[model samples]
Target chain A: MAGLLLSPTEKVFILHGVQDDYRSDGRSNIDYRPMELETDVVSHASGSARLRLANTDILVGVKTEIDVPKPDKPDCGKLEFFVDCSANATPEFEGRGGEQLANSISNMMQKAYHSSQAFNLKQLCIFEGKQCWKLYIDILILECGGNLCDAVSLAVKAALFNTRIPFVKAALMDGGNIDLQLSDDPYDSKLLDVGSAPLLVTLCKIGDKCVVDPSAEEENCSVISLIVGLTGDRKYYYPKDADKQQSVESKCTTIGMNGPGSVAPKTLKDAINQGIVAAKSLDEALGQALLKERQQNIGIKKHSYGFLK
Target chain B: MPGPDLLSSQGLRLDGRRPNELRRIRCKLGVFTQPDGSAYLEQGNTKVLAAVYGPHQASKSKSTTEGVVVNCQYSMATFSTGERKNRPRGDRKSQEMSLHLRQALTAAIKTELYPRSQIDIYVEVLQADGGAYCAGVNAASLALIDAGIPLRAYACACSASMAWRNGEPEPLLDVGHVEEAAGGVVLTVASLPNTGSIALLEMSHRLHMDYFKVVLSRAMQGCRDIEIILDKAVRDHLAEGWTKQDVVTI
Candidate 1:
């Protein structure tokens, strides 16, 4: 993350604004920036989507390929996430400048989607252990506004929803080799079940309240922030805190925060409560948007308005 | 080669196009509001977006007294090709493509006009079916024009492949992914069509020296054809108040 500089007076101005539940940018504490999303933008990829939230631009493409599953996880499939921070975003990302940030974001996404509850990999399996469909979720970071993790997660989820894996016809054994038959019909494909996919929500603690999506200027005012990944149901949060003692039979935890700043115990509770409420709305909005795009007839007749006209 | 089955007995190549015919090219300028200039181009199934950032103050180390430094970066989307690529830009192939992009654009840009300055042209290939380098160059030219940069002429690039048809050597124009994978000799030419001066020419497979003239001329003809299409697009783009919807109206 590039550190933004703000004067103490400026910080106080933002802090005062957050304390009242109103942000410097006219957004409420839990309100997000105005977002523009488009799907089926790239014709070459199996599925693609571009999302712009304020200054943050994220382009996600999902490519499908056939590969043998891991020995231990033979019955499951694979999903790999690769994030590229191109120099087009900023001069700072030139050369190997953005590698650290890119790696951290990819790692966080890997952690969030690591659990089976968050993503069912078994659905991608084509055979018992010999073959499976591997999905390569490539995320391109065009611009980094403030909440990159949240924007990326949203775009990835949308891209996954747009993906269509070609139908596999049959697997026949000839002597010692296996021959796979694939259906040529473009419409004969399977759509991934992404309802349970996790969406990341970044909460910046400004003053005593937490804000969902912070601008670059607002980010400078806060010392620490929390990145919480939640599904639509909000039934659980992955990577439970090891410090917190819990019973094995208990339900999943609902809060995840990361920050260097300390908050009052009451403020922490309030922030967690707000985070839950915000996550639910975000998921619902995302789900509806994806569903609408899916319902629409997406075909060659629909002119692809990529960055071009 | 897929043998005699690729080219039909009617002399039509795969996808039902004549040897000298090019894929449909559609382009738009000034697509993004943030960059100084930006353009998007689709060569058949291949889609590319290019953005121009500057001609502003050059970096301290890169500043030159005689001419402006032209910096280019070419990156393909991970899912652009049939198989997903692990990285977008840092790889050796992308680095080489960036160099080739600079070579073509530099020939067209009037670098000496803006000394001690730098121009950043970034090209992103959203979908690559083949001829990615040519598409990148063509898109960058449009973006440079949209940025209002001083240029000598439109930098046009096209590719040609040689095939034996009925005992006669036939040259294909604007080779697509299918033709490129046929393992025939491919000749790529980037030129200033009006000046008839070539900036860069590369050949992937070896062909007889006697056939070079025909193949090169065919690629040059492709460049001329592309220039016409691009010129029409620019004119139509300007006539439509430079809006995306208006450009795509046709």
Candidate 2:
């Protein structure tokens, strides 16, 4: 995390602002900062996305590899999360300084997606018990403003939505060996079922009140923050499809707590509820943005404005 | 001796680049606000981001009275390459690259003015098509400039490979991934083009002594060409950042 040094008076101002439901940047407790997102930016990976939430910049690239499924979960695929806190973000992240923070974020993502309801792994299965597609979600933190978990999870979901797995035909050969043939046409691929992927929301508890998407200054004034991961609604991902609009309620997948301070049980419960609301809105906006971009890119070459714009 | 078909019959190298031609270099400075200076650069398919912090107070152990201490860290993203990497940093290759970056940047920096201070340069390679080290150096130089740090001149790096065409050795400038994979001799040179001083030079594989000068000179030329592009970009950035102040004479 990037350290932000604020004076006692500044902290008091922010704390009072949170109590009044109006933050310094004119955003309410539930309002998030403006974000810029672009998907399929990295050509080398199967899918990639870059998201900038305020000053926190996150780039995620998802790579696919074929591997044998575990004996216990033979019908499912695997999703592995890796977070790399680049030294470019801050000097403290140089060498192995950022490893601990990176591990915590990756662990949160892993736990969030561990449930089948949050993400269906069966869609990635190629040969059921024999082979499966393993997705490696590599997240690169370019900058840390605040609320890193939320930005990372959002970028991961966007990248997974952009992932395209090539169509392959597998046949049982001699001695139970599987023969796989891949389609030559690049467009002949299947998109991942990422509509229900989980998104994490960090709710910073400030002066007995919780605020979503805390800025760096606000985070410095806070003592503890609660992270909640909630599954997204599939209806919002695909636009205007009445059949897909069979409203399925969002479910909680994972909960995490950070900072050295303790919180009351009642405050913790309230914060979790606030987090669920924030995640729901965030997921809906992200899905709409992704679908709109896809629509614009249809039947045309996408001119990627990576980092330039 | 020509081992692979790096050059076509029409004297064009792999990736359709003519001899002495450089790859497309697109760059922007001040991409991030967190760091004092940040830059993103793309050379052909290789993309790199660099951030510079300091001329600030150095730690007690690392402080020096003579000149500013230059610290460098070079790390690649795990998904930057074709094969997924387990660790992004703290590896032998990254450490070596960090040291090499320090050497190249130290030559251009005016370190004597900032005694008892330290400047940290961190370069991250987001895509490793080819010539990643060269792109890293170039991007770091831009970031240092963006920080308003004093430098002798722009330190640019470029790579060149050697190939034989029509019984004559032809030097290929700005080597791409395919040419590098062909196992030809690649010469990487970082230099201050205006000052005409080589900061760091590295060569991979074997090349005959007779053709070494040609390759080195070609790489130096490539550096000069890159310097022109970077200088123009800096000027444009400055012009855009500081609009002319309106003055009224009554």
Candidate 3:
């Protein structure tokens, strides 16, 4: 992390603002900065998305491969997360400098998606106890502006939503071998059911108060941050259709704490509650945006606005 | 032995491109604000983003009095290629690319003017459909220009491969991934088009001595065409921001 040099007075000012539930940028404690999101940005990827939350730019691409399922979990698919902290984000990340941070973020995502209720791996299964789809979720951190965990999770979920898996038929061959045939048509594919995918929310503990989506300056003011990953509701994902709505309770899939500071038991509990609320709202907004984009893409050629826009 | 059919019977390449035609290039400068300069470039399906930082004081171990040190790093996203990559950087291939990038960009930058300083250029490939090194060079050049670094000239790079069209030697410009993987000789050239000077030239695989010149010339021609497009983009970017400065001057 690049440290921001702040005088004691500026730190006190930020502390006082956080105590008042008002931030320097006129945002509430639970308010997140405006973000720009675009999907299907990378043509070579099965699914891809780019999200710019303030200045923290994250690009995620999902690539699908066919492989044998694990012996213990023969009926489920695999999801692997790889995070690359690009040197372009900062000179400090050059060479192997950003490996520690990248590994931490990837581990966080891996844990968040580990729960079956959060993401059903059965959807990726091609053949029982045999061939299955292995998705590689590659995350590229182009720029850093704080609140990276939240942004990365959001981008990953969006990328998964945009992913299209081709239909494959498996035939039982002699000696327990399976022959697979893939569809030739590009559009003849099924979209992943990402309605229950988890999203992360980071609550930075500033002066005994926590804030969501802290800016870079605010992040410097805080000594610790609690990250909570909560599963999303499908009802919010398809609001226009009542039949598709399911009243699934949002569950906590994973929780992580960063920085060296420690909090009291009561404060930690409150922060986790705050993070859950924030994640739910964030998930709703993301689901609505993705649904709208998909609606617009129907029967029309999608004009990809990648890095150009 | 003749290579795979890179050129169809109708004289079109596998991607429906003419032998001398370069892929469509869309580029934008100043794509990021944190770095001193940044640019994004898309050459066909290959996409690269480059960022440049500093002409600041160099670290003690790498300092030099004669000229500024140009440090380059080339990394590709794990999902950029058809096969998933375990590590994004520090690989032998990426390290070699970093050195080649430095070699090409050092030739264009006026390094002597900023003695004992270091300029860092980092390029990240988001999607690699082939000619990633060429796209990296082009993106880095635009990023250097955006950083207002003094340059001798715009350094552009393009790759060319020799193919046969009706038993006649035909040189292909801007080889794509499929073409490069076809086991043909790919000649990559980086040059300053305005100065008519070559910065870096590399060839993969072997070609006949008689046809090397033709392939190299075709790559050079592609560089010239790319230079024109880059120059126009720079001018357009300048025009967009000059309005505010013009009012202040008045």
Candidates 1 onward: DockQ, in order: 0.37, 0.53, 0.58
Candidate 1 lDDT at B196 equals 96
TM-score between predicted and true chain B, model 2? 0.95
Model 1 segments more than 4 A misplaced: A1-15, A71-74, A172-180, A233-265, A298-302, B1-6, B164-166, B235-250
* Candidate achieving the largest lDDT: 3
lDDT of 1 by residue, B165-214 (tens): 77788888998998888888888999999899999988997888998999
Tens-digit lDDT track of model 1 for A1-309: 464567899889889989898778888899999888888887767888999887778899988888899999998999988898866676567677888888888888887787787788999998877889888888988766789988999999889888899888887988756678988887899887776787888889887778988887887788778777766442222123423633232111234555577777887767666776776777778776766665575554665566653
In the range A27-76, model 3's lDDT, one tens digit per residue, is: 88999999999999988789999999988899999999999999999999
Global CA lDDT computed for model 2: 0.91
lDDT of 2 at A295: 94
| Segments of candidate 2 deviating more than 4 angstroms | A169-172, A240-245, B1-4, B242-250
| lDDT (Cα, 0-100) at A213 in candidate 3 | 96
What are the iRMS values of all candidates? Answer: 5.1, 4.9, 3.8
Better of 2 and 3 by lDDT: 3
Clashing pairs in 1: none
RMSD of each: 6.0, 3.3, 2.8
- Candidate 3 chain A has its poorest 10 consecutive residues by lDDT at A237-246
Give per-residue CA lDDT, model 2, range A1-309, as digits (tens): 466688999999999999999898899999999999999998889999999998889999999998899999999999999999998788999889899999999999999999998999999999879989999999999998888999999999999999999899545566887877777676899999888899999999999999999988888988889899999988878656748468788899998888888899999888888887888899989998999999999989889889887
**Quality of candidate 2 docking, DockQ:** 0.53
